[model samples]
Target: MSYTPLLQQLIEALRCLPGVGPKSAQRMTFHLLERDPEGALRLAKALTEAVERVGRCDSCRTLSEAPLCPLCASQRRDRRLLCVVETPADVLAVEQSGAYAGLYFVLGGHLSPLDGIGPEEIGVDALLARAREGVEEVILATNPTVEGEATAHYIGELLREQGVGVSRIAHGVPLGGELEYVDGSTLTRALAGRKPI
Candidate 1:
């Protein structure tokens, strides 16, 4: 049995999403085709809108539909304190914890030499540049992974040279747990117990 060319193409494209395997892609295709045609159309429209309208925040580099993200635009957040994270999801995690009332800097990714991803590729230069502009403290909130550690150390050194204080978030976070997966209470405690780098 063969799927129509359009269905096969859609399934193949869906498989490109993170953690979506071929079987899952096929299941999703069939589910969408059989059960929820309107839902599928809505999903397609939302995906296209997100891809076309959303972009990186100019100040913090987090994903945004406007020129700046809500955090960047908010006067309530402490501009002097900056939390450097690997992605927008990290920022959201920290935000949900309600423990951090400071601004954020999203690196977008970690530095992985094996993957040919370096500092420049992940917006490290932009972060360093931001650090030079009277930033008081920078909390490294990157993931608890090897590449994430490398990125944190690199930024710490750069910020230190710029006369800005640098700190790394506590490793009390569970091993292999992404910030997005950790509960808000645990994340709050981690932020509260952060140590200097």
Candidate 2:
């Protein structure tokens, strides 16, 4: 049996979300209609408001509700140290770790030539401009993927030409992971980045 036009529309709209297929979207539509219309309304309102108000930070390119995000506005963060990340989510992850106190420059995405993403698409020139304005060190916090590595290397070269120090975040076996279960590349990186006791 076919769903009503309105219900089908809702299901189709819900499927626009990442990882949500037809079954998941239909489930969500039914759940909202039958169990929680109020919650669904709230979700819709929040999504509309966020879409209207949220924009990229002028300096860092991270999502923000204002011209500058709270982190960018704060004086406590180290201006000399900048962390380059592939996404705003990465900035949040690094912040949650409590190990970094630097400002951030979100690339919005990594380098993926096959997918048509390039230095300009990721805002590398803007990042370089930011680096020129008194930034002493840049820590590349991009993912360990090939695209992320290429993005970091490209940015490292740009920063080097500008006389700024650049470093990549270490990639290795996870903490508490046994060596036997670790992948070859990760194990190799872990050994390469090993520090003196």
Candidate 3:
């Protein structure tokens, strides 16, 4: 038998999430309806509020409720250094590391020519403008994917012309990883990026 119209609609909507297939969507729908109607309502309200209030930060392109995100508004962060990343999620990951004290420029996404995403679409001009405003150094923290590397190289060249110091985040073996399990490329990068102890 088919689900009631409302239930079927809910199940279909759940499938819009990444990695959520038909079976998972159906299970989520049933679980929410049977055990957590209140939780479901809360989730709906949160989603609605986020969709209504959240938007890109004026300066950095990260998600924010106001013109500037909290990080952009902070005075304690170093203004002379900027870390360029692929997403708001990457910003969060860097923040969790507590190793970066500089400001950030979120690209929203990497360059994907096949998807029609280019420097303009990802706001590279905005980033360049921001860099021109006394940013002395730019750290490219884009992911290690091909698109990410291309985006970083493009930005690096742009910044180099402006006399801004540009650096890429070193990619290599993870801290708890064994060298035997590390891929050859990662091993090569680790060797190339070696530092004096």
Candidate 4:
């Protein structure tokens, strides 16, 4: 064996994190054991606490310790604008942009029929129920992947049927991205979504 059983187990556990391959996990394990054992203890403590205490917000379905997340409970946010996204991380991204001052509805994931994930799995009924509670516009902020697109389209149609306005967050070349470096699909999306000043 390359490592002691406990050491190998630590490396394997570390690999569970996104983008952390075997070599990276091994390095992290070594760093934790040799460089900063105290930090490792803190990380373990925090992860355990979060797993025990954190849960989905009753209102938006985003991860939260309380029944309603801070964003859903905020009185200052615009109630008429509801931004629907695929995950908790997406909610953080939109909040970090500071361009949106409205409430959010986190879908937890997009529809993927092959994986047995569908409208019910992602809480479409809950979203529709939320929309009917006074939201005027639902901005679909789902990722631009095939599954994300399908999920958004499905939800958009349902929202429209209920008389709620639906819009999609534009997807294309990123800010400061060069045209030559951009892919054809992204370029096409950019062109299609362009607005005249």
Candidate 5:
């Protein structure tokens, strides 16, 4: 029997999520329909609200509901030390380690010319502007991937031009591994053992 048009549409919509295939989408649609309708409603509502309410932090470019992210807004954080990462997930991973007490600047993404993503596309200018604002140290916590390395290098150059101290996170992070997937201890070590860029 064919699924209803609305159900099919839901499945298709779910497939747009990263790593979610047709089978996973179909299974999720069925599970949401049968086992957890209220949960699914809450999920839908939260997704809508997050998409509408959450936006990039004006200064550091991290995702925020307000003009600045919680980290940027908090006076308790070390404003002098800044950790630069590729995404909000990276920020969360570093935060989970409880190692970094400084503020963060999320690039939103890495440099990828072939993918049509450039410095302007990833808000590198905003990050450079932030770096110019008397920050003592800027940690390049981008992933160990090619694009991530390129982004780190690009930012390092910009910060060096501004006479700002720049450092790259230590190689404790597995080669080609994403920060979000690395263990907390490893992340902590990477942060603590950071070296000059």
Candidate 6:
């Protein structure tokens, strides 16, 4: 059983999406072509519009259409504090927590040397350039992965040289998880990072 050339192309295109395997792509292609072509057109139009309009914010590098993101442009935010994250999604996660009211600098990715990704690829220089611009403290909110830790350390050292206060986000067990159920590595970190009551 073979699909037409156009249908095959569509399936391949859909496979490019994250987590969309060949079977998932085939199912999506059929659903779009057989059940809802109109919906497919809407998806295509919206994706095209977003691709054309969305770009990096000049100040923070998060996804935005304007020169500066709303957080960077707002006077209400604490300009003295900056949070460095690895991606736009991380910025959204921090925003949803509602605990941080500072500006952000998105690295867009972690540093992976074997992949040929380095400070230059992740815009470390750009972030360093903004360190002296009234940002007294930089809180590293990178993920808890090894690469994320390396990135945070690298950036922290650079910022310290610029006379900026740098701090790494704490990592340990989850708020709701029981101590017995926690993994040894997490428990070890939790114990190591224990705070005074």
Best by lDDT: 3
Residue pairs clashing, model 3:
none
Tens-place lDDT per residue, model 3, 2-106, is: 999999999999988999999999999999999999999999999999999999999999999999999999999999999999999999999999999999999
lDDT comparing candidate 6 with the true structure: 0.93
Two-way TM-score contest, 3 vs 5, winner = 3
Name the regions of candidate 5 deviating beyond 4 angstroms. 173-197
42-118 per-residue lDDT for model 1 (tens digits): 99999999999999899999999999998899888888899999989999999999999989999888988898998
lDDT of 2 at 101: 90
lDDT of 1 at 166: 96
The stretch of ten residues in a row with the least summed lDDT in candidate 3 is 185-194
Q: Considering only N, C-alpha and C atoms within 3 Å, which residue pairs clash in candidate 1?
A: none
Give the runs in model 2 whose Cα sits over 4 Å from its true position. none
- Residue lDDT tens for model 2, 137-176: 9999889998888888989998999999999988888989
Compose the digit string of candidate 6's lDDT tens values, residues 103-129. 999998999999999999889988988
Clashes of 3: 0
Q: How many backbone collisions does model 5 have?
A: 0
TM-score of 4: 0.94
Whichever of 2 and 6 has more lDDT, that candidate is: 2
Name the weakest run of 10 consecutive residues (lDDT summed) in model 1.
168-177
Deviation in angstroms for 161 in model 3? 0.2
Query: Candidate 2 clash total?
Result: 0
Per-model TM against the reference: 0.82, 0.96, 0.96, 0.94, 0.83, 0.94
Which stretches of candidate 4 lie above 4 Å from their native place?
Answer: none
Model 3 C-alpha lDDT versus the unseen true structure: 0.95
